[model samples]
Target: MSVIGVVASATGGVEQLREGLVRPLLDREHQVAITVTPTAAAWIAPAERWELERITGLPVRSQPRRPGEARPHPPIDLFVAAPASANTVAKLALGIGDNQALSVLSEGLGSTPMVVFPKVNAAHARHPAWAGHLDTLREAGVVLVEWELLEPRTEAKRELPWDRVLAAVDGLADQFFQGRLRDRGAGVADGGDG
Candidate 1:
């Protein structure tokens, strides 16, 4: 079974995003695991979890961990961090898996596809380190979905386009499956028993 792991920061519309994506996956009978970061849990309530359970029929699990706890590897076929915070982005890039979210990424088995959806303001996203980190991930074959086209004014509210975001999610899933299949082939060749 294909496992799609969705991880999000405690930002606006995170639950809505998760709900939206999970619905389609459920309709198609795909396995979806919704993992919330520590920051995400602070804002999401029990009511929200109940709502998600109703909508997706999938139990929502939070990866509550501090800076040093080891993360559990759930055989993640594809890992996605949406509305990704700048702090989390930096931590992932620098190999600083201090929290559950970052820690899970580190513990992900080799050849597991990873996607990062950055939701920071345009200015923050343009930082040298951020840009470099993104480039590094790309070179390492990690898919990055950045909202650079949106221009946030000084007093403007940042809003992500759901349509575009969903489309990006679909694209990431495609890439992830391709990578996983290639890796499976490699594994088989290393020790073929067939």
Candidate 2:
């Protein structure tokens, strides 16, 4: 099964991450490894954190490992950053890895396929640099789920479109694997051992 790295920031829908995204991915037979921003780590309730660990069978990392320590998670095939806060999105665009979550994402920026859902309000979108940040990420091959697609939320029901995000991930993973297979086939056709 493919291992998916889930990077989350402190956003409105973060509290539902375990139920909305992780569990669903697990049910789909994907191994999930999660890393969260420092603030998000603090914001998540203890019981929820424990449940995340229990369900994923992996540690929920928020800080960098000490020097010379073995990496805890397996190599990730893809990344999903749901409920990505405006602050985190901007920092990612700038290649700033001030925290563990950003560090993992920064290293995977170009090489790995990623799906990002910007959980921002109109005020945040109105920032002068917001568009530029999104453009930069897009140019780097990040698939963005535009905030407009997740509209019409009632004040009491602030939920995210986790299913849509998962669909994007599935689509991208298919494309990535198909491209690799085609490349391998081409090499084999040319009599080169693949």
Q: Tell me, by lDDT, which candidate is best.
A: 2
Q: After superposition, how far is residue 27 of candidate 1 from its true place, in Å?
A: 2.9
Highest TM-score among the candidates is held by which one? 2
Q: What are the runs in model 2 whose C-alpha is more than 4 Å off? A: 149-156
Clashes per candidate (backbone, < 3 Å): 0, 0
lDDT of 1 by residue, 50-143 (tens): 7775665565666564678654434677777776777777777777877667777766623567777776767777677778977777776677
Regions more than 4 Å wrong, model 1? 53-59, 64-73, 149-159, 175-194
lDDT of 2 by residue, 1-194 (tens): 88999999998899999988999999989999999999999999999999999999999999999999999999999999998999999999999999999999999999999999998877778789999999999999999987463333544555698988989999998998789899999999999998
User: How much does each candidate deviate from the true structure in C-alpha RMSD?
Assistant: 4.2, 2.3
Q: Candidate 2, overall lDDT?
A: 0.92
What are the lDDT figures for the candidates, one per model? 0.68, 0.92
TM-score of 1: 0.75
lDDT of 1 at 51: 77
